[model samples]
Target: MSLDLGRTASPGSTPRAPGRLGVPVTAAEALRYLTDLGLWIDARRSQLSAIDQAALNAPDQGDREALTHDLTVSMALWKAIADRYELLKVAFDSGRVGPTQAEQISTLIWGRLDVTPGQAGEAARSRVPSTADGALAVSLPEACRLSDAMTSSLRARLALEPTAMDVGLRVKSIREGIERIRDQIGLIPPGASRDKANHDLVGLEQRLFGVTERAKRGADVGGYLGPLEVDVAGRERDLIVAAARRVSGERDAATARAKVADLAARGDAIRSLQAQCLRDVTPAPKLGVPDVRALGAVPTDADAVDAFLRRLELVSRALDQAHETYARALAEREELRGLLGALDAQAATSPAITEDERADLAPLHTQLVATLASTPVPLVRARALMAAYQSYLQAVTTNVRGPR
Candidate 1:
């Protein structure tokens, strides 16, 4: 059920002038202009009909009466123009009117049109004598112009344009905007900035109240309402930006606090490992572990939080280096102990070693065992002694085998 309204004019045809108070110089132009004018009249009639219905349904008594009176006058004026246009169109379409007659008909468009008795009587009573029979001396174009002006005013008054919101809807929207701004204002910390924002909001609320009052009285408050809406919108935007910054700052602070706790726990674990390493391994790397508690609690300010996070990163790196140093020292100590024990077992079990070699190896093995068993063992000395013990056992084996 779709309908194409068709194009306004034929392709390649120049647009006709709007309802001007001047006649076309040629008959063809005049006929074309008349056809376009008739189409315009039809469209205007439909628009007026819709407006008439809206006026009848208006809730306000004063608005309905005022709108209905204006619509009546406008429709009457439109009828006079349409009737004249119809007469000229028929005459021209008959194919009998010559250039001279067409010129005469063109005068009807640029000349006065007929008026209703009410208009004629008013004109007559006013002593203007502008009407002959029932026709007024106002040109058709002038009549159309008057009707157009009235129609525009009516549309604006009724909020009939597509982009024009109803008064109640606009008021509600502004109120909602105010509430949103209020909520954002609450997010602002108590400071000079928040106070200033509150001041601006108060002003906007006052302006809104004035606009609402005018609207209730049926006054055209559009001029007042528009600027208030812009101010409210602009203020809301500023408050929203401020609120977002505050939330971001709080989030960063929370994250920094969590990081502080994590780094503190890690520092304690690294210290414990360092103590163990000191007890078991001599000549350990003397790296100092940083005390994360010295950095203190995370700050509330955004800039301070950033600085605190950087400090945490440095502390974390320090802990990593210290942990690696201490853990590696412990690992080396355990590795040497395992190696020394394995070599001693091999020598005691080997059949290549005679009883005399066993007596030779026993004292050196006892000294190596005492060195490993000592707390905070001297790693460098332990390694040297283990190497000597292995060499002595290997020599004893070679002697037992003779020339292998």
Candidate 2:
């Protein structure tokens, strides 16, 4: 829409932030509005210029009152629109429209409306759409498209026209593709081939970012976009191809490496547990656990590595069982030893004890000694020895406490 150039800005009208304008706006929206406005003004430049000249030239008395008033309003409106366009253009070129600039823009476009001397009259005659809701609704990409079109139209007005380009959309699509490729790369473990692919993709992203920056600076990016898009597509294809080749090797190797690390940890744990078991056993039986150090050498082949892992698993399970068996038998043996110690103490303390007491205690003490002397003492035999020893001690105590 045309702006009113004759309308004087409000006396106290200081620039305000876009947030203060009570409208939501993104960088794209500002760009679009500015671009569209510029093109619109350029389109009506001749018509507007003629109306302005005629009003200026016409006599005050015979100035065709209707034409005079129309020309005045049109000139005022065109100027206002142009001023807004310049404000937005500067903001757009910066590639960023922070809240404050955005607010200034919205206020300039929709907040100030006193373009004509007679506000009431202008309001009655004007049919311009209220920008209250419009500014906040426009998005950044939409803003870019609008701005790009305006740039093209302005250039055309001077016969220096440039081809239109949708650089924003291309850049956006390429970026999305890059992100997807990155996610795929995450699934594949790091390696030489993947690193090379990643390096190439990174370079491509930088080039695309540059293209976007050039577009923001009002460069004719139409030619640049095509080559960049092709490069992005090709790079994306190469990345996928690269990932495909390396993924199997990297993933398998990664998985194998993980298995090897796990096996190593498990082997250390099994060895520790095996040592514990040997210590618990009566004679510390030789743990037949194949040397854990031998498994440290991982094979390069996937199947061979997998087989080695299986062997480790089997060894771990056997060692675990050995630990349990030895620990149980050890607990029993310790209990039997305690009983033997009690019997020997009682025998030594009571030299005057009767023959019957000695006979009963002798058999119990013999059983305890036999059980303790046995290598890798069996849990069942040790339990029986402890029971017998307890019975003998209880009988002797009862006899000593009898009426005699």
Candidate 3:
């Protein structure tokens, strides 16, 4: 609900341009499709952190490990993002198509507005259309905000993470929210306060997500470096008090202004006093707090919650860094696994593949490399998984496709 829906002007929002067959969208239109991406990500990051904190608090090792998965790279983050875009494209491309459903699905890759609507459907989602002057149509989802499609794709490859349907549902919910907005736009007036009301606030975050840089500097809260989340509860109360003041004429207005000034001054003093008190209060010893440096001991029992989270954080941070290495490894591993799966499927269904690196081309080598370069990792789970999987793939296909 606290989504800071940025105020970026909608780009290339030429109301459904003339695409080949499906939605005729420009590259920039995609940028306007979502908003507050950072806030959404921050929320997810918070969820992950909370999960780690919970695991730390759990009594049993197995329970702790179960909760620990929550601290890992979100299983759905990538796929959810991609699928939302996919659904967005689908809703837009609903009427667009060649002669078959397969052809329509191919258009999912994007780029084909100039293909002369006639030929657009013909090419279908087949050969990705190269724009004039020759360029790839759109860069696949690469930003953070862990999407469902990417994670689903990631899981299918690794076979290590949970394969819950909730992940899929979570993504569908987001896209549905977006689609609902587009559906309702024709009914609502733009810029009305109401336009911003009654929404998940997540959809609006896409506004500046892909186009601008977002950092959680404004949203993130640190224990040692920050006060308890600004309490904003008090700020809200003060604002209400400020708003509730009665002012009829000039004199009443003046009186209200003076009261507000006094309240502000008092609030500032209160904050200063509170800070001073915090600085002076002696923290009770938690095994080592009082004798921290003197006894060469530190707070080891950071409570169960804090201790578990610290471990999760350590592991998560390491995994977040190694995602690229892991992702590339995952892609390669998926390809190998797919190849093997297809070989088995074909071996059962028909004769062997002839004249091909792969034995079964029944699905016919779509061979698209969708790079989830921005995928997130709870590092703890992903690091060991990727290392082990990558090592296994290397042992099997050492001479295969080089690191994607």
Judging by lDDT against the true structure, name the best candidate: 1
Q: After superposition on all CA atoms, what RMSD does each candidate show versus the true structure?
A: 29.4, 24.1, 34.4
- Candidate with top TM-score is 1
By TM-score rank, best first, the candidates go: 1, 2, 3
lDDT for predicted candidate 2 compared with the true structure:
0.52
lDDT of 3 by residue, 275-338 (tens): 4333332221111011111212222221332333344344334333343333344354345446
TM-score of each: 0.46, 0.34, 0.18
For candidate 2, what is the TM-score? Answer: 0.34
Please, what are the lDDT tens digits per residue for candidate 1 over residues 58-103?
9999778767766776677778877887777665654455766566
Model 3 global lDDT (CA atoms, 0 to 1) = 0.32
Better of 1 and 2 by lDDT: 1
- Write down the worst ten-residue block by lDDT for model 1: 123-132
Deviation (Å) of 164 in candidate 2: 11
Candidate 2 residue spans exceeding 4 A from truth: 1-321, 346-353, 374-382, 399-402
Clashes of 1: 0
